[model samples]
Target: MPFVHIELVAGRTVEQKINLVKEVTEAVVKNTDAPSEKVHVILNEMQPENYAVNGELLSQK
Candidate 1:
């Protein structure tokens, strides 16, 4: 089994998220020899205010 964790600022559509996971699963399977069903992808969506860079919150950008 292969575990993949992805974090991003919230706002993407459902279709986009679906495509992201599907593509990610394919990549994992191709590179790690893991079965599609055995690959685990965890997506963590955070609010812009909860993410920051260089002392500035994403929401402020």
Candidate 2:
């Protein structure tokens, strides 16, 4: 089984998230030899204020 974690700023559309999960699972199944059903995809969406880059908050940037 493969566990894939994806983190991104909040506000992504459902279609975008769905596509991401599909592609990620496919990749794991293809390269890692994991079964499609055994591939786990986790998406963690955080608010801009909760994420920071270069010590600057995403919301501020």
Candidate 3:
């Protein structure tokens, strides 16, 4: 079994997240020999206010 965790800023379409999980799971299954049924991919979405970069809050300049 393989567990993959992904974190990103919130605000994405369901289709986008679905495709991302599918593609990531497929990649792991192919590269790591993980069973497709046992592979897990989790996407964690955080609000802009909760994320920061370069010492600046994402929600604020």
Q: Find the candidate with the highest lDDT and give its number.
A: 1
lDDT of 3: 0.91
- The alpha-carbon deviation from the true structure for residue 43 of candidate 3, after best TM-score superposition, in angstroms, is 0.9
Candidate 2: worst-modelled 10 consecutive residues by lDDT: 1-10
TM-score of each: 0.93, 0.93, 0.93
- State the lDDT of candidate 2 residue by residue for 14-60, as single tens digits: 99998989988888898988789988899999999999989999989
Show pairs that collide, candidate 1. Answer: none
TM-score of 3: 0.93
Report the candidate with higher lDDT, 2 versus 3.
3
Candidate 2 clashing pairs? none
In candidate 2, stretches whose alpha carbon ends up further than 4 angstroms from where it belongs are none
- C-alpha local distance difference test of each model: 0.95, 0.90, 0.91
What is the number of residue pairs that collide in model 1? Answer: 0
lDDT of 1 at 22: 98
